[model samples]
Target: MKKVIVLISTYNGENFIREQMDSILMQQDVEIEIHVSDDNSRDNTVNIIKSEYSDKISNLNINKIGTGAAAKNFLQQLMRLSESDTFDYVALSDQDDIWNPRKMIAAVEALEKSNSKMYASNLTIWNNSDNSTQLFKKDFPQKKYDYLFEGGSAGCTYVLTRDIVLELQQIIKNIDYSEWPNFSHDWLLYFLVRNLNEKVFIDGNPYINYRIHDQNVHGHMNTLSVKMIKERTKLFFNGWYHHHALHYKKLLQSNSLEYKILDNFTKSYFSRMGVLLKYNFQLMRDNKKFLMFFFFTMINFKTPKDV
Candidate 1:
């Protein structure tokens, strides 16, 4: 049996933590050891894990990051795991999502079959309010610069080989967290893997139940919804996107063609439009999203500035 280490970052997730943990424990055909980091949950999340799952988990740390920084919580786990060599694969987990019994095994098999270092899969979105379920497709063909704009999928569905995890550990060590903007860990992982020219396999099948609720930090089922569009527009205009692009460029420290293209796109509004025209703005795999990206670039008036 292959050993897998699962890292879970929790906030105030008392309502669904049991269900999620149960699903993880039920994963088949892989040896499982869980590591959990809590961000000062005011609820019974920590208590439940300790009283119920103490024997099942490998380690648990109650890091009181009162600011609810999920990305930091996850990254800290990666840094800790860098010291160990017991696991063949590392997977990220959210406190609220339920994994399928075959999630880990399927990911491991896919990675081995495709000879890829990183893996991400589509998910089933479960809306708590309506009690509805929908398949969220993220298996679109990989675009040339998709990682520059969006993550391949949610972080919960990501599985990484041990070598990839070690590489990410080194990258994290070099990153200055104080200056690091609030970027999602999933997107950063995808960017690093693709930017470094590592092979990644995106599975078309859904293997996790992604719950959407009132307390969701970043959950959206409809990409074309007005709410999502407005949120994306706000981020684009507020220099969030530009700031990330520039920061990633600095981290790469490369004169490669891809980085150069990203640099040109971040230079100015006109240069961004030029890049969009050059590629027909196909940075996004979905056609509608590409159109939206074009619209956001066209109306972005603020010049790129160091944040």
Candidate 2:
């Protein structure tokens, strides 16, 4: 039996933590350890955990920090513990969601059976108001290339082997997966692992109940007004454009054909060409004002400058 570490990241989640914990505690197979990284919640979260669970849980406090920053800090703490020993796997958890009893066992079996570095499963999306639930399964392309380009996967579904988790720890120390442009840490992890050609697999099991409510940052953003949509669309375009350019720029700076190919081929789409080109061009201009300056300095005055 593999010893798995359940790494749950949370903040102000008093309303649903007990349900999530009870589900986890009820798992029948394999040995499990629980680690809670609390984002310095202002409610009865910590106190409740202490009173109910006692020493069965370990907690990390990230008082007054962003979710991304809190996750990074908690992972760093995990790294410190890792110097002495290793856990068979690291499973990402959200405070508000409830895990099915078989989640951990099934994920472990899937990882061991396939020798995969990472695994993500389908989830049951639960609506907070009407008690409606839907299974969120992805119909990804059979080819890895297609999956990389069509990159929308659920984060709370991730499970990583020791080696990949450690490698991610190193990569995140430098790149900080949480801060990647409105992108979920799961998306960054998926893209990074895929970029490295790591062995990743997805299973068709709805072992998690993804609770949706108004307070969720990402969930709420999806229902904004048309005007808000336009503004956020512009922001998303700008952010993604800069992110891709920086990614390719790193590849070029490193002079690696492997990364360059991955970057280029992953983004080669005809329909999105015009929009991506505009974004990439603006990204370049913003980063390399000197190049823009030199062009004007070298060329003869063409038309009256916008003065």
Candidate 3:
């Protein structure tokens, strides 16, 4: 039996915590332990976790940290753990999703079959507000820089092998805080894996009921219409896109040749029609508008090319 440790981050999930735990405890064909970090939830999240799952779980650790975003909470949990052979795989969980009984089994099987270090799956997005549901199904295109602009694997669906868990632990041991992105540990992990040239497997099977409520962190469903594209572009220039673009502009300067292409592309596309010459641009220099459209669309939304 494979041993898997799930790292869950909770803020205020009191209502759904018990149901989520029940679903996880019902998982088949694995020895599962849960380690949750509660970010100072003002609700009864911690009490409910203790009452429902404290005795059921093989290993349960519920920590109360400062109030913060999910990224910080997850990263802290990862950084604090030591390298160990205690578990064969480490999976990520959210306070709100219900895992299918076969989710862990399928993730482990996919990693073995692909000979990869990490695994993730398409999720069933359950919009609670509208009572609508859809499958977030897409195959992994296995391209470079897909992780940077497009977060390849949704964090909650992630399950990393022992090798990858060790690699990330080592990164934390020697990470440069100044170079860290202020958000999205999922995207940063993708960058690290791609840089290492490790094979990543993302299954198309929907394995979890991903809840979409008003409190969703990043998994909002949006139609890919042209008007939505404009809205996404506006959002791109507004926050994460601009910040990460500038971040990559500096990071790519010292990275591989493919990244230099990304850097030049960024500068030229952000320009109107003149700054192309200023950027010493080659390879995707022309078609600035189309490039912008593609870049923004990919960065802002998901494509088959994404992870």
RMSD of each: 1.7, 9.0, 6.2
Determine which window of 10 residues in candidate 3 has minimal summed lDDT.
298-307
The candidate with the higher lDDT, 2 or 3, is 3
Q: In model 3, which regions exceed 4 Å deviation?
A: 58-67, 176-182, 221-234, 245-255, 265-307
lDDT of 2 by residue, 1-307 (tens): 7877777777788998899888877776867778877777888888888899766775545546655543454455445546345578877787788888888889889888988888887778787877878766552433433323233356677888888877766766665344444444655666667666776777876888888786564543333247545654554434443354344334233466434443542343432343334333332212343243234323422221110
Residue pairs in candidate 1 whose N, alpha carbon or C atoms collide under 3 angstroms? none
Per-residue CA lDDT of model 1 for 236-295, tens digit only, reads 777767777877787765777667777888887788888888886458777777887788
TM-score of each: 0.95, 0.74, 0.80
Model 2 has an lDDT value of 0.61
lDDT of 3 by residue, 155-257 (tens): 8888888778788777655644444444567766766675578887888898999887767656563333475566666555555443554554444435666
List lDDT for all candidates, in order.
0.85, 0.61, 0.68
Query: Using lDDT as the measure, what is the rank order of every candidate, best first?
Result: 1, 3, 2
Task: Tell me how far the alpha carbon of residue 157 in candidate 3 is from the true structure, in angstroms, after superposition.
Answer: 0.5
